[model samples]
Target: MMITMMKSYRGKLHLPMLAGVVCALAFLVLLYNERISFLSSTSFMRFNTCAARRAARDATDGGRAKIDDMEEEDKLEYDADICDITEGRWVYNRSIKPLYSDRSCPYLDRQVSCVKNGRPDSDYRYWQWQPDECSLPRFDPNRALRKLKGKRMLFVGDSLQRGQWQSFVCLVESIIPKDQKSMKRGRVHSVFRAKEYNATIEFYWAPFLVESNSDIRIVGDPRKRILKVDSIAKHAKNWLGVDFLLFNTYVWWMSGLKINSLWGSFANGEEGYEELDAPVAYRLGLKTWANWVDSTIDPNKTRVFFTTMSPTHMRPVEWNNKDGIKCSNETRPVKKRGHWGSGSDKRIMKVVGEVIGKMKVPITLLNVTQLSEYRVDAHTKVYTETGGKLLTDEQKADPLHHADCIHWCLPGVPDTWNQIFLAHL
Candidate 1:
C-alpha cells in the first residue's frame, strides 16, 4: 500500500516538481557532506531546481527565516547608499490613489474638505505622486502612529502649511479611537493630541517665521502683511525639542508689496521700520530662521523639513487655458510631462535651496512645488464654505472674489506631500 502511494505521488508530480524533490533530498544529503559544494560543481539547471525547492520549502515553513535573511541583505545593500527621494517629478499612475478619504476621516476640518463641501468630481483624488527613481511606500497610518508615539510633530508656516497639517491629521487620526484623541486651539497654535500614543501633532502660525506685524494673535488681513526680517526668537522658542519640524514661508512673501522690517519693537511704532525688496527681505527672514535652527536644534534628536512653495492656480494662462478659467471648475491635472506652471517662482525656490544648503543641521527640502504645479484642479475653489455658509451666487460668479486657488483640498495633493514625508521618515 505504501509503495502504491509512492508510485501515485511520483506519477502526479511534473518534471519541475520531480526536480525540486530531488533537489530537496540532495540538499539534505549535502547538509551532512559539508565538503560537497552544491554551487561550485552543480549545473545551472540543478542549481535552479535546488533554489526552487528551497523557496517552496521556505514558503511552506512561513518564510520568516528567509525573509529575515533578505531583509538583512537589503539593509546591508541600502544602508550606506540611500537615494535622494524628493528630487523627482510627478507622474500619472492609475494604480495608486489617495491614502485616505474625506468622508472616512472624521478629523477632517470643514474648510479643506472639498468633497464634502459639494465638489462633484472624483478625478483629483485618484492622482498619485511618483518619484523618478524609487517607489514611494504607501502610507500606513498605523505604522505612522507607531513611529509618532511619544513624539511631537509640528508644522510652522502660513495657511497652506495649516492645510497640510489638517491633511496629515486626517491621514493618521483614523487609526486612533475617538476617545483617545483630543484637540485644543489657540490664537497662533493648535494641538492635536493622541493620548493613547502620547503623540502630539501641532500647527503654529508663523507665516514669515519671524516676529512680524502680521504675527498678531489674529491676522485678518493679508494686505497689511509686515515681516521682521531679523527676529525669529519669539516663534523659534516654541519649536525647540520637537521630533519633527516642518517649516514653510512663501505666498505671504510673493504678495508683490514691499515688506516692512523692524529694527526696533512694534511698541516703538514705525520708527525702525524700513521697506525692503521682497526677495531680499525673504532671504533675511530665512537667514534669521536658519540661524535659530543652527543654534537651538540638536541634529541627532530632531528631523527638520522645509516644504517648497505651494503653487497657486489663480491664472488660466499658466495652465494653457485660453478661455481664462482659474482652478474653480477644472477637473483634470496638466497632462503634459514636465509642465512648469507659471505659479511657482524659481527665484524663491533658489533662495530656499541656497539657505537650506548652508545649514549645519541637515534640513530636508520637501520639494513638492513642481509636483503641485500640475494640480490646478485640486483647490478648494467656490465649493468651500466661509463662516459656516456656502458662497453666495455673486461670490461664485466672480472668480477672483471667492475662489481659493492657494490652499489645497483635503485628501488631495497634500496627502502626497505627507506620503513622501512618511517614506522619508
Candidate 2:
C-alpha cells in the first residue's frame, strides 16, 4: 500500500499543480528582491546626488559673491534669518515699529486721506495697483513674511491668478537661495516650498471654483452628467490646516457670461438658461466657496485672502492713445490712468466685491486688478521665454492664443503684485 501511494504521488496527474506552486513562489521571491533593491539604491542615489548638487552650487556662488563685492553675503545672512522665521521663529525687529499709527485702523495706509473713487491708500504707497487710496488696505510684510515657514498658502484661479502665485514665489525665493527652493507639480495644484522658510505655497487651477462644465464629466451620453465635486475636494484638502489661504478665481469667466452646466436639479426644480446668467453662476459659486470656507477652514491660525479679479487686456484702443492693436508692444506704464480708474472692468468687479463682502468669514481682499490692468505692455505674448525672444511665425499658427493676451511676463507685473502681497503681509 505505501509503494502504491508513492507511485501515485509521483504520477503526471499532480505534476502540473506542483510545478504551478513552485513558479508562484519563485515570482514572489523575485518581486521582494526587486523591491528591496529599488529602495536601497534610490536611498543611496539621493544621498549622493544632493551632496553633489550642494557642493556645485556653493563653489559657483562663492565666485559670484566675490565678483559682486560680497554684497550678497550680508543679504544671504538676512535672508537665512528671515527664512528661519518661516519655521515659526518670530524675529522681532525693534527698529520696525507698528506699521499703523491709528489703533482704530492698524494699517498705515488706512490713515492717509486720498482721492475719492480710487484704489486703497494702502496700495498707493506700497504696490500702487490702484490710483486712489480710499479703499486700499495694507499688510505689514515685516510682521508676517517670515512668520510662515512649513505653512501652506494656496491661490486658486485662472491664468491671471498665476501672476500672483509667481510673484509670491519670486519674492520669497529672492530672499532664499535657488538651491534651497524646490517646486513639485501636483495633479490639481502646483506647489513651491522653500526649505529655508519651511513654507509651502500652492496654486490650484480652479478657474471657477464651482461645479461647472469644466469640472463635470459626461459618460457615454453627453446629456448624462455627473458633478465631481470630489475632484475639487481632492485639492481642497491641501487647503486644510494651512496657516494662510489666499483664494482667487475670475479670469475663466472671460466669456462675458458663465456657462451653466445642468447635472440633476435646476433652481427650484426648473431647468434651462433663462433662469441663470453669468452673474448668477458667479454668485452661486462664491456662495459655495464661502460655505466651504466656513466649514473646512479654521480662522484662528489661518489667514484667508481673496484677490479681486484682475483686469483683462482686450483692446489696445483705450490703452494710452493706441488703436486697433492689442497689448503687443506695450512696455511703458499707463500715463493716462493710475491704478484701476474709471475705464477698469466694472461688470465683474461689482459681482466679486459684493459676493466676497457678504461672506460670514472675513476674507482679505488683495485689490490688484485696477493697478495691474495698466501694465499691459508688461505681458509676454509677442515674445518667447521670459520675453527674451520674439515669437516666430510657426508659433503663431497654433491655437494656444497669443502669448501676450493672457499671462503676464514674469519679473514685471507679478513682481509688484508680490510687493503688494508682501505689503499686506
Candidate 3:
C-alpha cells in the first residue's frame, strides 16, 4: 500500500510539469508571430515613404514618370492636357537662379530694373514658380530667339504690359551679339529688334485698349482717365499681322464703380462723358477687342495671349504692414498659401473669362494674377527711377508719393511670366 501511494504522487507531479511545457510552447509561438507582424509593417512603411518621395519628384519634374509602378495609394492623378501651369505656389528653391540680372541686361527699363538701380535686397531674384503638377522649362534665350526668328511679337496695354515686354527683350537680348540688336522708342511704341534673326518685340502704350483721353504717352492723373468703351480699332489697327500678341488692361479699368466713357473721340472739342458700370464697360471693351481679333487674325498664323491682370501691392493692409507702409522695403514674398490680396480684381478676371469663352477665335489667357499676388515684394516700389531721374529726398521720405507697386522688377516676376508664356508657345 505504501508503494501504490508513491505512484499516485508521482503521477500528479508529472501532470503539472506537462502543463508548464505546453504553456511555454504557446508563449514562444505568440512572440514569433508578433515579431513577424512587426517586420511586415516596418517594410510596408518604408516602401510607402520611398514611393511618396518618388511621386513628389515626378510631379515637379514635368510628370514624365509612369504611374504603373506606383501602388493605388501612391498614384497621382493628373492630366497634363488640362492642367493650368500658371496656377501654383512659389516654393523656396536654392537650385533656381535668376535667368537674367538687371546689370547684365541693358534693355531693362530703369523703372523695372530695381536691383541694377541699387536696390539692397537680392532674395526676390531667387524665388521660382512651382506649378502644382509640372515643371516649367527654364527660359533659354537662344531657343526663344530661334523660335522668334523672322517673327514679330507685340505687347499691348498699360505700363504693366510694358514691364513684361521689357522682360522679354532682356531675356532674348542676352543671347544676341550687342551689334546685332537694336532698341528704339517712338511716341507711342517701343521696339527691340534682333537684327540677324529679323525678329521684333514691340510695346504699345494703350492703357484702355480702346482710344481714351488717358492714351497719351504720359498719363498725368489716374482720376482723369476716360475710356471710349466701344472703340478698340484705334489700338487694334496697330496689332495687325503680328506673329504673337500679348495684351493686358486692368488697373486703368478699376477707377470706380462707373467708368467715364466718352461717346466721341478724345480729339473732339465737345467734352461729354457718360457713366457706365465698370464691369459692363469692361465687357464692352473686351468684346470690341475680340471682334477685332476674330475679323482680322488668322488663328492658324497668329497666336494671341491676354495676360490676366498683374496684381498691385499698393495697399499696406493686405500685407499686414503699417497704415503708411506700402510694398517698399519688403524683402520677401508673402509666405502664406492661397494668398489672394486685395490688389487683383476677381470681377475683372471673370469678365475676361466670360468674354474669351464666347469668342470663336482662339485666345490663350495667361492667368498670372494669382501667381503674381504672392509676389508683393517683387514690385519696383521706392527703389526705382522714372525717366532716368533719381528719387528726390522728398519723394524718398514720402514712400507713397514715388512708390510704384504696379510694375514688376525686371529679371524678377516677369521672367517667370515669360517662362510660362514660352512654355505654351
Q: Output the number of the TM-score-best candidate.
A: 3
Candidate 2 deviant stretches above 4 angstroms: 1-145, 177-179, 213-235, 256-258, 263-275, 320-324, 338-344, 384-391, 394-403
What lDDT is obtained when candidate 3 is compared to the true structure? Answer: 0.72
Compose the digit string of candidate 2's lDDT tens values, residues 119-153: 12222222233211011222333334476766778
- Which is the better candidate, 1 or 2, if ranked by TM-score? 1
Q: What would the TM-score be for candidate 3 when compared with the true structure?
A: 0.78
Give each model's whole-structure lDDT.
0.72, 0.48, 0.72
Pick by lDDT: 2 or 3, better one:
3
As a whole number from 0 to 100, the lDDT of residue 262 in candidate 3 is 74
Write one digit per residue (lDDT tens) for candidate 1, span 1-425: 00000112444654434545576576556446432111111111122324554355456556744422322112211110132333244455667667677788776777788888777887788877554323456778898898899999999999889888988898888778889999897778999999999999999999889888777554556446566788888888899879999999999888865777666467555455778777888899999999999898998899888888898888887678867657876878875655676678777877876776677887766767767887888898987778668777788788777898887888888988887677667
Off by over 4 Å in 3: 1-80, 217-219, 266-268, 322-324, 386-388
Shift in Å, residue 41, candidate 1? 47
Residue range 248-343, candidate 3, lDDT tens digits: 999888857788777657665536777788888888888888888888899889888888888888887777767546787787788666677778
Pull out the clashing pairs in model 1.
none
lDDT score of residue 50 within candidate 1? 46
RMSD of each: 14.1, 27.3, 18.5
